[model samples]
Target chain A: MRGADILRFSVHALKGYPVRSVLMLVAMAIGVAAVVLLTALGEGARRYVTGQFASLGSHLLIILPGRSETTGAHPPILGETPRDLTLDDAFALLRSARIRRVAPVALGSAPASWGRRERETTVIGSTADFQRIRHLKLAQGRFLPEIDPRKAAAVCVLGAAVRAELFGPEAALGRWVRLGDRRFRVVGVLAPQGQSIGLDLDEVAIVPVASAQALFDSPSLFRVLAEARSREDLSRAAADSRDIIRDRHEGEEDVTVITQDAVIATLDRIFGALTLTVAGIAGVSLVVAGILIMNVMLVAISERREEIGLLKALGAASGKIQLLFLAEAGLLSLTGALLGLGLGLLGVWAGRELYPALSLAPPAWATAGALAVGVGAGVLFGVLPARRAARLDPVQALSGR
Target chain B: MIRLQAIQRKFVVGDQTVYALNGVSLEVEHGEYLSIMGPSGSGKSTLLNIIGLLDHPTSGQYWLAGKDVTGLADEERAEIRREKIGFVFQLFHLVARLTAAGNVELPLTLAGLPRPEREERVRELLAAYGLTARARHLPGQLSGGERQRVAIARATVTRPEILLADEPTGNLDRSSGREIIELLESLNRQGLTLLLVTHDPQLGRRAARQVQMRDGRISGDGRGG
Candidate 1:
């Protein structure tokens, strides 16, 4: 038959049984929508994490005190002890040509009391260059002075939230706040920078590294933050920092140095795999939809046996009969896929509105994949029913046996 | 022209081989109006099905228009059926979903005629069948006589050389049955070959030639008025 006529006939058949057609369409549509929405969520999470890490600053590297793994495959008889990374090791990293700045970190929690207002909060101890290296901005006064490394100067910077709590909207600069047993003058108030990488920047207090070491009564530093001069120098800066620390610790190499690119790359790999897995799980629903189409088409064949017989008696070839049935399946699935595309996009839009921080958009591949699978499922699942219709005995069918 | 030689069709019914058509040979010239009449289980319908190429005889040699068609492939038979034959059934068998015009246009559509020509032919055929006003009406909404007329229009839409009908008036009322019989007779008189199968002796006797079947074989063959 003419292609147009075939399409018209199939459309007429579907319209004849609106409920059944809608059922199949809904099954296929839900399957496609599931794939799209779930993949959007997975990809949104990936983007969120990538954006979080991006805000930490570019060409950055972090140095931790302990190695995550031992050198040899054999288990350490006494759990290989790690050497402490101190301020001296942090100063030594500045000697590398590729390293632009290094800030030794000492972290501890202490209660700060200003008159009657007292709140317990985390204290981050680093050098004056920490402001530039970590991309911190001052709202009032100046950051800690570039002072002698060995001198213990009592000066502090209050985060936006900490300033608000202790000073109560009044000027927080030049105020003395007692932290634990030590009293430090607040030299600066940080700008209102929100949370990043799980650390609430607004609630923390920044102090000079020597004063924090004395306040916390600890000799070892928590970590060291370093910035490379350029993107190309990041790897070299990381290697040089590790080597410098290893040499200062008498060749122990106990410190772990991680570049920002490496961390972002690892996160990307993890999230990429997660997105694929989520999409694959959603693909199972498509298979279920395909099976539904098969079941419905089988029922259609049985119900339309007399119609098939009539067509055959009207000189329709077996191939034509098969084609007509397959056309019906294809039309249903294609329509369903289109409906699902709209639904998935609507879902993504709703999610974005509810959580503005997340970049939730359906990927192009997901849309294309959904469409391909939809039509392919219809045609593949249609084979058996179409063949059955084609193979029907016209005499028996006409006799309604 | 059509010819069937020693046509044999057997049915295996629970270890009993029932002969539906046994070594039945028949020939029909172009434009000849013929009818086959028999009681139930006498294989009149079976003979019609074989002649109409809806069923294959187990062992037979059949020729149509001087071409051997017994061993023809399914698609080739379908092509011949499309071009050279049309069928009318007792149930009218109009596709319930299709409009009257759509039903009449089916064979032309199947033959891949262009839309304009197919529509034109359908309009002409519907007007000829006195169903032009009901062109958009579905079979369910059509009367018995109207449905049969639509079926006849569908059957001859491709201008087939022969029309095979089985119990064409079996489901119609007396007046509708008379109208259908007269229509078939008029088509036969217009030099279109007609082969009808029926059990009604009155309708059977109206054909130009009659063949009587009993026990899977032809018992009598003679010319009528």
Candidate 2:
């Protein structure tokens, strides 16, 4: 039979059994939709986290006081190093022409109180360059000044949540708040930044690095944030920071200097694998849907045996009959796949409306893969039924056996 | 033309080899109008099925239009069945899902006739069957006589050289059965070879030639009145 005729007749046969056709269609659609929606969710999470990391800073290197690379020995817990990464080591990194500026980081929790309101908040210490490189904008007042490394400036910056808790309705600039045993005047109130790279910036206090060292009674710094002068200077800045730390700490390379892109790339690799794993799990449903297609097709062949016989008696060859049934199966799959794509897109659209921060969109490859698998499964599972229909004895079929 | 030489069709009914056609030999010429009549289990339908290439004889040689069809492959047999033969059944066997016109167009569509030609052929055939007004009705909606007419129209739509009908009027009322018989006779008169299988003696005698079968063998072959 001609291709068009085969398709037309198969369509007629599917329409003849409305309930069965609809049931089969739903099975295939749900499978395809599961694959699409799940992949969208997985891919969306990867993009959200990777984007957060990318927005941390440009041409940046974060230096921490520990060796991240293993040396075939027992690793230290709580970042124990041979020597402390001091303020002098952080400033010495500026000697490299590739490095633009460095911000020494020291953090500890302390109670800040004003007029009976008190809350224990994380206290981050850095210099004037901290606000610029960390991208922290101020709602009021000014950041800390560029003072000598040993001199403790009795000034502090309040995070948005801390300001609300301590000075509620009252303006906080210049207000003195006690931390541990000493007091520091509030210099600025940071604008609200809800969350960035897993850190809650809205609930911390920023102070001069010297003050944080004295308030916490610790000499070792937590980290050093270094800025590279240009994109090409990034790798050189990291190497320069590592060399500076090694030179200052008894010639021991104790600190880990990590470029911003390396961190983002590591995170990207982890999340990319996670996305594929979830996509694979979702593909199982497509296999089940393929089996459903096979079952329904077998039943359809049995129900339409007389019709098959009639076509054979009308001079249709076995191959032609098989083509007719396979066309039916293929049509069912194509339509179901398209419907599933629309359903998944609609689901992602709804997800975006619910959580706009997460960019929930299916990747192009995911969409194409889902469609290809859906149709391919339907056709593959359809082969057995089509062959059975083709091999039916016309005489037996016509006799209604 | 059709020829069967000692065609033997055997069936294994629970380990017993039953000869459906013990040793049936028949020759039919083009445009001949004949009927094969017999009691039940006498293999009249089996013989017709063999001649129509619907079944292969177990141990025999058969020829159709100068081709050695007995040993031909299934594809070749299907080609002969599709191009040179048509069948009308006792139950009419019209596809219930299709309209009258669609049923009539089945053979032409299988033959790969273009849409325009298929539509034209179906329309003319329905008109000749006095069914143009009922072209859009499904088999379920048509009367028994109309359904049989639709079947006849479908059977001849490919312009096959031979028509094999098995108990064509077995399921119809007397008036509708008579109408169907006249329709088949008219097609036979138009130079299409017609082979009818029937248990009704009156219907069996209406053909110009008749063959009587008993125990899977032809007992009588004679020109009818």
Candidate maximizing lDDT: 1
DockQ of each: 0.80, 0.78
Docking quality tier of candidate 1?
Answer: medium
> Mind giving the per-residue lDDT tens digits that candidate 2 earns over B26-104?
8999999999999999999999999999898998889998888998777777888889999999988889989999999
lDDT of each: 0.88, 0.87
Q: Which ten residues in a row have the lowest lDDT in candidate 1 chain A?
A: A69-78
Listed per model in order, the count of residue pairs whose N, CA or C atoms clash below 3 Å is: 0, 0
> What TM-scores do the predictions have?
0.95, 0.95
lDDT for each residue of candidate 2 in A1-401, tens digit (9 for 90 to 100): 67788888878988998998888888888888888888889888888987887787878788877876421112234455446678988899999999888899898999888878888988988899998888889999998887886678889998899999898899999899987777999989999987876568889988899999999999878888889999889988888888877878778888777788787777777877887887788888877888998999999899888888988899888998888888989988888888888898999899999988889878788889989999999899999999999999999999888
What digit string (tens of lDDT, one per residue) describes model 1 on residues B72-121? Answer: 88898889889989999999988888899988988888899999999999
B1: Cα error in model 1, Å: 1.0
DockQ of candidate 2, scored on C-alphas against the true complex (2 decimals): 0.78
